[model samples]
Target: MEKDLLKTPIEFLKGVGPAKADLLKTEMHIFTFGDLLTLFPFRYIDRSKFYKVSEIQSAAAEVQIKGKITSIEEVGQPRKKRLVAQFEDSSGRVELVWFKGAQWIRKSLQIGTEYVLFGKPNFFKGKYSFPHPELEKAEDFVKSPMGGLQPVYPSTEKLTNKNLNARGIAKLTKALLPQLKGVIHENLPVRLLEHYKWPSRQDALFQVHFPTSIEALELARKRLKFEEFYFIQLSLLLQKDRQTVQTKGHSFDVVGERFNTFYAEHLPFELTGAQKRVLKDIRKDTRSGHHMNRLVQGDVGSGKTVVALLSMLIAADNGYQSCMMAPTEILAQQHYNGLSELLEGTSTRIALLTGSTKTARRKEIHADLLNGQIDILVGTHALIEPVVQFRNLGLAVIDEQHRFGVAQRAKLWKKNAVPPHILIMTATPIPRTLAMSLYGDLDVSVIDELPPGRKPIKTVHRYDSNRLQVFGFMKEQIALGRQCYVVYPLIEESKSMDYKDLEDGYESICREFKRPDYNVSIVHGRMKPDDKDYEMQRFAKGETQIMVATTVIEVGVNVPNASVMVIESAERFGLSQLHQLRGRVGRGADQSFCILMTGQKLSNDARTRLETMVRTNDGFEIADVDLQLRGPGDLMGTRQSGMLDLKIADLAKDGQLLQLARREAEGALKEDPRLQKPEHAATKQFFIQKHKGKVQWSQIS
Candidate 1:
């Protein structure tokens, strides 16, 4: 066997012809022999351990037993026909049955033979039975050292249809191992292998697929998991070091009149300690004359917007233009209005650009932006349009940064000769492990404290039995001159019959407090843009006492006077969404409340989510629990697929392992930053091969 042979098409393997090869390729993406070699097992079981019929107690437990079949018989009608066999050893006797492939099994197994049987045993009516136990002659089974762990591979029905189950896969792996001996090249460096006491690449692969013992399997798994995490950390660290050396940035050497004037005259309130700390970090990056790729994370109402505004002002004072990109038009408009009010008497000119901008205003704004008349430009994805050129764009602030794609952010780099400083802000706090893996290449700054004078929102859980009581509470809050939001989970009546249920709830609310006494504004995704905006504005302006909507209002809806958030079917929503909806309230000075209303029956995960919401308003804690419940993919949504390319490692469970991997990667880089040493060549080559065709976000940023 040679290196080229390992790369040979899997169809060349024995017992796998053209038809089976095609099915393997289509179903499992196994094109080459090497691909099949790396399909590791998900679990393993003891093969040597045997049990007697008298030792069986639990029906759910699988056991291996040594016995001889005394007799065999077929029972039941045509469709329900089954083959049953009486198996007996010196200790006891057990019945074995097969519902599928009974005729084939009957033909394959012989009676009056000493065979080793392995299967799960079930007990009913004081009798124990083994269903379709694996049958092999005692002498044949004894020849193979039959006491080690057996590998169980992940398989699909399509592959199983082609007679390629877990056992079949193990057989193929057993066939391939002989060829791979002395053929697998070492991927990790010699020093790393010696220091970690890890096995060679060949030994790890073989042991992981077919282990001789439990200890060997554990060592094999550790080696592979470490390799997976090490490469990711190496790539991120390399990109980060490259950015610091290669990308030059506009230096805001002095915090002059614009920043000073806003701080002195138009400052909204005293900055919180977390806000001050993050601002200090940003100031240091801007002053260093190196491109700043930083992420600012804070919970809702943590005053992240004020921090963004202050950073933009620093860019302005340095005689450079700045822009802020948001995920939606509503959010962009909110930023524009808030910043406009903050800089009312300032000399800096701010402009807004979104999809709905008028043609005449768009032309004026474009002209001003190109010539540097507009000091700061705030907009949605429209800021990335071809015509949206800027004059010396020094800083770019992205709000709800996860909503935008890498390519969209890359477009902002073309606005100037040099890439502008990037400061990404997210209100949904990310757990530490997720943040480390996801944004490891960038500088992370967390704003952990809310601004002073903001009281924590009082959260309560309620059942459907207290529907009238909850409505009365809402009425009481509204009577006190505050607005309320009633959020439902679904929108379409046809899709979720519960949409009709929500409509009935809405009708009841209207009927209870009718006419001029209480005007309610309803908004959802189905409504037209104008209609939705109209309703939102009415509620924001205090013209409407209550706003009924869906999760579209989860982000960017800032109504300071709103004090109550009544979430219907709260169990149906995730922890992050529920937190964001609750954030809509508690923005004002008055005491705020969030009522989580759900049915009596709740799932374990759903109950944990609701309890976490009620217990604390800490976004980081919620995010950690959410990660444990839904994993990184569902928590981060669609844009995280490319970034979280973990194959063998688990982010939630392997946080400590990831930290060790990152430290190892960093130590290696510190010793040889460019990996130019002969000893580092293997590690460098391994990284390139592992990350082929993948766009590294670190490089793009």
Candidate 2:
């Protein structure tokens, strides 16, 4: 009976009529009682303290006051009118003003009756007033159930216009809570609840919405957050278990000639301990006989490519072809070039395929790939097209994994009979907390250290006024036979403005550097693929002294001779993007520098981003700051699986809670892999209901 009531539409609630219910559904996505119940407050007010009219200060925040409505009148012109009431307590008098619902408020308000007014106090014309104050009869206010803390639910202007503001939503929640008394069954086992000393599920729901005190609110928040993370981790871990048990992967047990030769003869530098550890994890996964789906997270220039190439070599030794996919043509070509250089002495056959590939070349590459003659294939999205088939493809490496959608990545799985050992590579370091929640299903391996002999890039912030000095520095670097990259921001939302900026910057660079002494190549998204590649190759081959471009060079322009990166209007870029742009330099040993150029005026967030870029080169540290500034949603592109849409659990602040929840979830799954135990019945039922109709993208990763 309680479950049915919880599922009932919001219109059936006491204070929500059909119109209000429709508004709630459209504005807040509150369709049923369950949705409304889970619409937790963003903040709360302390109603236990009330100030007298005389005690209210002009600078005071939201305040509650006790007073009597001595007089009321309508003022101002039609459609611009407001109702004002002069209210007096024993000490002083203040005005209560209403602009929106004046007529209804004036009709309901009783003069000479004591009432409680709650709102932010605004001071104007040498007087203090409460605008659109929440008015309640003194007697009713005393008898009200919401006494200690007042929940402030999230609201919209449309909802506020329809009298469904935070207070209105709170009223609806208050009325609906009683109906959930017996309905909020415990999804977690009693043993777990007792072990954590947590409140009952029903009690937590009530306290979270209308807590009696701060202590109760904290406990309630913890319990709910744990439940959210626990269930998500449980679901992800379950998917991982199922994949391990059911999916069969080709065993690349023998690390034969190619891998050993590359390690002993072709490796340009010694592998860092972190890289070695990650490679070990990858090797273990590939040979476990279960489909390998692993994510390798490393800072930019952390040698993730070498690890991926070695993994591919292992697949080649196992007599299976491997393929690497990048999001852009430039990156694909760069990978192909780098891998080709590494395997120059070996007999390994590698091919590059992209939209820019000639028709004849693509046909040759396609035929070779199908006949198992191609040891490894590297390309952009073209690799996933149906025309591209692989003979016993054993390993698949994806760079910048977040740039591809789940469906796009899933296409690679269909390229072979059994899905290849999937390896996802990313230069953007993900915080451990976010990784657990975002890519929880995949086994994660991080290359935490950069390869030896790589010097940390020096970063500094400069205002636009310092442009001449920056240019001189660039010239000095160029005079030393090193190249420079001048990058302009290219935000998609304002492409025209960005394009103008890029054009203006490029022109200025050409005029300042001059043609004869300094040759500059420009690249942007609007450039033809061939033109962009030509410019990129010019920069790569040292034919161009300076490369003026947009974020197109952000991923894959490899120039060891390029040592200076000047990001124009650096404040316009994000933390991760700034780190990536800085990464473009510092690839070589010659003391690279990243100069962040910004305008004098900077917003606090923009300042933080620039400051963070100047502070450290640790990608994970920068990523954590990025998460705090831009939030989890924007940091991880919006196309992610819906798991990060957490209702109450904040990935930024609740790291410890997430860790605890993950450990508990792992323990639970270890005890009952299928969640079929009698003690786990509630958890299993809740997990199924929660995840119903959700596409499992874990398999693709």
* Per-prediction TM-score: 0.93, 0.94
| Per-model lDDT | 0.87, 0.89
- lDDT tens digits, residues 1-701, model 1? 44487789999898788988898899888888888887888888798688887888899978888889999999999999999999999889999999998888889888888898888888978999877677789988888643479888877888787878887778777888888788788878888789889898889998998888888888888888888788778887877776655689889999999999999999979999999999999999999989899999998889999999999999999998999999998889889999999989889899999999999999999999988899999999999999988878999999987888878988998889989999999998898888877888889999999888899999999999998898898889888998899988874445456566567767877998788889998887777889999999999899999888877798768999999999999999899999999999999899999999999999999999999999999999999999999999887766556667665678888888788888998998888877778888877766666667774433322
lDDT of 2 by residue, 101-136 (tens): 788888899998889988898899988988888889
Which residues of candidate 1, in runs, are more than 4 Å off? Answer: 1-3, 70-88, 92-97, 106-109, 122-137, 143-147, 491-502, 638-643, 692-701
Report each candidate's C-alpha RMSD, comma-separated, in the order given: 3.0, 2.9
Q: How many clashes would you count in candidate 2?
A: 0
Task: Quantify how close model 2 is to the true structure by its C-alpha RMSD in Å.
Answer: 2.9
What's the lDDT of the predicted structure labeled candidate 2? 0.89
- The per-residue C-alpha lDDT of model 1 at residue 153 equals 84
